[model samples]
Target: MIPITMIPRSEVQKIEKPGWVLVFGRRKTGKTYMLRHMVRHENYFFVTRGGLILEHEEQLLYPVFEERIKNLLLKDITVVVDEFQRLPEKFLDLLHYHSPDSRAKLILVGSSFSVARKLMERRSPLLGIVRPVKVGLIRPVDLIRGLFKLGISPELLLRIAPYIRDPWIMRFVNPGKFRRSDVIEAIRFNVPALIGEVFSEEDRVLTDRYELIIRALSLGNSTPGEVAGYISGFIERGLRSQDVKSYLANLLRMGIASRTQLAGRKRYLYSIESPLIDLFYYLDTKLGYYEIDVPMEELENLASVKEGTYFERFVVDLIASLYGARVQRSLDPEIDGILVKKGRIVAAIEVKMGDIAREEIIKFLERAPKEGEKIVVAREGPSLEGVSLLTHRDILSMAMNFEQRF
Candidate 1:
């Protein structure tokens, strides 16, 4: 067994608010771990699917467990319950009547995305009682800062750093033995299980249509038209572009997919959000259902080609979020992304995972948007004559600022 490294979750501070808290996020983003370690509670319970509750490490039936929770809350003691959705309606009503008035601070953590949203509906008994805390994947900057503590070099770190966002990868990333293959290995084992759990939590079943769309996005078909076309090739019943767009909305809300509008057009581009998820689906597509038996060398070669694209996206997302801005992809093939804040374009960014050539920089200079700031980000390269050059060193600065802000 491999030891895991623990990092502070920046969202924990939000749980410190005065009233009750409802913490929810996709599974494996570490919601349970954060609430267990970072919050103050007098009693902790884990509710099982069959209505059996494990309180203080002792299992009890619904009646006994409900009474214990009531007694603690009435005594003004804080309480935490993981998988609160699994409990009966009575448990929710118990809190609806008691949580706000009682001095007890209630921190409930749940993984079901569907149920979590239902709690905010008009008829919910606890609708206005608890503050909602959403936890997403490890922020790019926070993940970078944590990995830097392992003394990993900047260039090598960029190669596999995105995989570390999945909490399961924490087990595979040993300080001295870590390498790109180590991450790939971790993905090989975890991706299927992770996808299943996420879908299960969302109360979704992956039909053939869902798989086709996910695979299409993995292979770089980002537009709804492209996805519809791709799926048509695989099935007799074809979906319209508008239908594809509607389906992608659920994924965007769940944080599994992301979309960026075209710079000047109303159309959008879609892609998988998690790097591990992207790579896994890419491998599944390439192997044509032979993913389980793919050779390590073949898997490594396939993953290498997509690493740069994922890295470019990471830079785009990190930079855009720093300014509380939105990112748009341009129609020009040469331009990667544009960051916009309050309806004004602030920068046009070009990210190169490999060395930048003078001719390449010159080409970018000629084609990139002139009204906004011009910037090129690379691992290591000579300075451009007129553009801002950012490197992993600069990213470190951003990472530090990001941690402090959260």
Candidate 2:
């Protein structure tokens, strides 16, 4: 077996809860990793895309696999099915049949839309018994704690957070020999294949259009109109804003894209959910790096130049998750994110990727929501009048407090 360092996730707390369960997420988010390490099961089966099943030491056809599940479940054994989405439609019935009356605990792990729809939608047979837990990219607090345990400083973790929280991305990182270039190199080398794996988790239709849409978002074409306009330049007969909207909706459902309400407006601004993906496509759009060879040094420089955009997005996601807030976007330039808690706008956050100018922080403080919180997240900053300045040290403290509370 290959040696690997597994990052502990807070999702395991949810996954360890009693009873039958369904865990789902976008591909490459480490659904299988968490299942294999954090949860306990007597039998683990892997269902392949071609409907073949691998159990302990044997490969079985669907009928044989179904029979095995029946036998084990009858004995009340804990069974985990990885890539459960690839199983036949009748698999749900098989689950519904044994799960209710038997003490057999079942864990079904999958990443596709079908698994989600069948198990989460209103009519699902297992809906009542199976608890659905979505395991996204590692939670920032969990990641912060994980890094701290590994003897990495909070200062370094802030730099690492944007690149490594995806779990799979950490494979390329050497914690002791940390460097920004290492993370950039990981993206340059791995993202194309990573995205292909993400696509495989979906039904894989209109692939070219999907790629163009992601590329468009990376190019800052965030609105439906902007996305349609950008994609139209490549295809014949053009596409309407509505045409791109459905595709965006699909991406959103698949957990590949995310959107936030444009504050005080019905419209929303969309972006790729994973900043790593955004940066990958952004680099591709800017340099055609995906199509031709670019020297690793050149790629690193280019990634550094555009780091602020993706870093700000990462901060917004991280802070929102930390504070139990929803992300709100605005046309306002001074603020990077408007955080909402319980439907009320709670804070305006400024994410600084470089030296913070005294005047810049003042400008943001003056424009930030006056009532709640004005947070400046940066490496370091002047205490400045009364605006709350937060560094990774503060964040690490928060994560520790959060962990203690929960």
Question: Tens digit of lDDT per residue, candidate 2, span 1-406?
Answer: 1113445687777777788888888888888877777777889999887888998789999988888888888775778999987887888888887775667788888887666777777888787888888887777777666677666666666766766667777777777677666666667767888777767677666488999999999888889999999998999978899999999998888887888898767999998878788888888888888778878788778777756776687777777877788888877654699998887888889888656878989888777777568889887888886778888678677776774222
Candidate 1: which stretches are off by over 4 Å? 1-5, 75-77, 289-292, 402-406
Q: Deviation in angstroms for 216 in model 1?
A: 0.9
- Highest TM-score among the candidates is held by which one? 1
- Assess the local accuracy of residue 200 in candidate 1 as a C-alpha lDDT between 0 and 100: 83
TM-score of each: 0.92, 0.91
With candidate 1 superimposed using the best TM-score fit, by how many Å does residue 404's alpha carbon deviate from the native? 4.5
> Local distance difference test, per candidate?
0.79, 0.79
Clashing pairs in 1: none
Q: Which stretches of candidate 2 lie over 4 Å from their true place?
A: 1-6, 404-406
Residue 137 accuracy (lDDT) in model 1: 80
How far does residue 355 in candidate 2 sit from its true spot (Å)?
3.5
Model 2 has an lDDT value of 0.79
